[model samples]
Target: MWSAEDVARDSVRRQGDGLPLTAVGERVAEAAVREQEAAERALVGGTFSEYEAEPERVAGIWAAKHVEWRRVRDLMAQCSWSRYEPDRDVQGSEWARSRAERRQAVLSGHAADLVRRQDERDELRAELWLSAGPSRLIRVAADRADLRPVEVLAQLAERVVVGEDGRVSVPPFSPSR
Candidate 1:
């Protein structure tokens, strides 16, 4: 079982990001924002084509999912520990054995959930390298409260210069120039 201090530390580290809140999630979100900003700068400065920018946008989606996965993992660990520890002390009782069996089933389900989350995380990570240029890489779900991948790409698109040759580029200088 997790100690009170462990739980407390986790809560404080979360810094107001809500339920299943995790410190890792907060850090990932910050990093994603920084990367997104860098990608935007590159796009506006003609340093990055839309093809190059797609991964940066997909990164935000990856960050959000990463956080969610870690949260699920943390919860699963605590639940498994709590279930096992009490049963350990009362091992000889028939009631304890029955309860342990039920708990084991639940823990097995939670373990499966953890595996699924890990698979999702890995898929998102793979997307960073496999994305096809000029095509959207990820679909943002409505429930997500993290960085808006589509909006970020759309903002960059507004500054793109498309020529008659069908090539997309940025102006040599900002309109102010």
Candidate 2:
């Protein structure tokens, strides 16, 4: 089983491994949707609990949520910097100081709006991470195979449980509280 913290660390590793953060997030979201649908199908057929017992499904759900959080977090960072770009460019131009002042005022208002958007994005990203769960059921349907080893490791930093004696146990799947 993979814990939320593990998933977050894996996302950072993936970001460092050269895959664009947004792309990784998108992929995870897509996979989550797919797995959710599969779980739903199993539920309809009355075999959902059995499916949920698979460790891979739990790992996948954790990974998907983590990646999504990272992606949105990164986007907020980009917005913060990009929003100031125009203002910087305008300031560096040869326009008269008076004209620059007027433009700067307008840009300042735009920057405020950008800040609000960033805040909203941050809230949504937090919600996504905090509310992370596999929709429908806890299982992966038969429509797809298990996640790749690299993908799993990228999303899960460590085993869910490591005892003082170094005994590791895979945690059972459970719905998010």
Candidate 3:
């Protein structure tokens, strides 16, 4: 029986493993945008074939860019600060208030970026899982927020075989497998 803490830890591990892919995706999108922009510039300067043959490639680049942008937007939404204000009568001293405001400003500036990066990484992992799914069960399992890791494993699996000794088996499965 997997505890909630085990599930949470596994989720974190999975997210961490996929973090590098997010950076790679970001770089790929940036390079694609630069290439597209250069090609557009060449077209504007009277080069006919510069942008003629790569419409499909350009479309893919833009699609990836859009997906990444949407991920960032969703991350920002998740990180939105609560609309709570301190009571005027119970407010602390001016020095303390100033320090708090400074701390908040720093956090909003720096911590928000870190949160966005983390969110993007998680989104990338989810995207990869979704892309690998032809299975409706996996799709539905991926969407579930309340599932334990073991439950999620069972849900996404094609077949779950349990032995008489209570050990469960999940075969190696992927789109190509």
Best-fitting candidate, scored by TM-score: 2
Sorted by lDDT, highest first, which candidate order results? 2, 3, 1
Weakest lDDT window of 10 consecutive positions for candidate 3: 83-92
Q: How close is candidate 3 to the true structure, as a TM-score?
A: 0.20
Backbone clashes, each candidate: 0, 0, 0
Runs in model 1 lying further than 4 Å from the true structure: 1-92, 125-177
Q: Write the per-residue lDDT of candidate 1 for residues 1-177, one digit (tens) a residue.
A: 323233322332343223333444454466457546655664555433544634434444434444533443455355553221222323223343554576688899999999999999865222233265443432332114243655434444467888999999965422211
Error of 3 at 13 (Å): 48
TM-score of each: 0.20, 0.26, 0.20
| Candidate RMSDs in order | 26.9, 30.0, 24.3
Candidate 2 stretches with Cα past 4 Å from truth are: 4-12, 38-177
Model 1, 99: alpha-carbon shift in Å? 0.3
What lDDT score goes with residue 5 in model 3?
30
Q: lDDT of all predictions, in order shown?
A: 0.45, 0.46, 0.46
lDDT of 3 by residue, 26-45 (tens): 54466467547755654555
CA shift at 89, candidate 3, in angstroms?
A: 20
Determine the C-alpha RMSD for candidate 2 after optimal superposition of all C-alphas. 30.0
Instruction: State how far residue 146 of model 2 sits from its true place (Å).
Output: 66
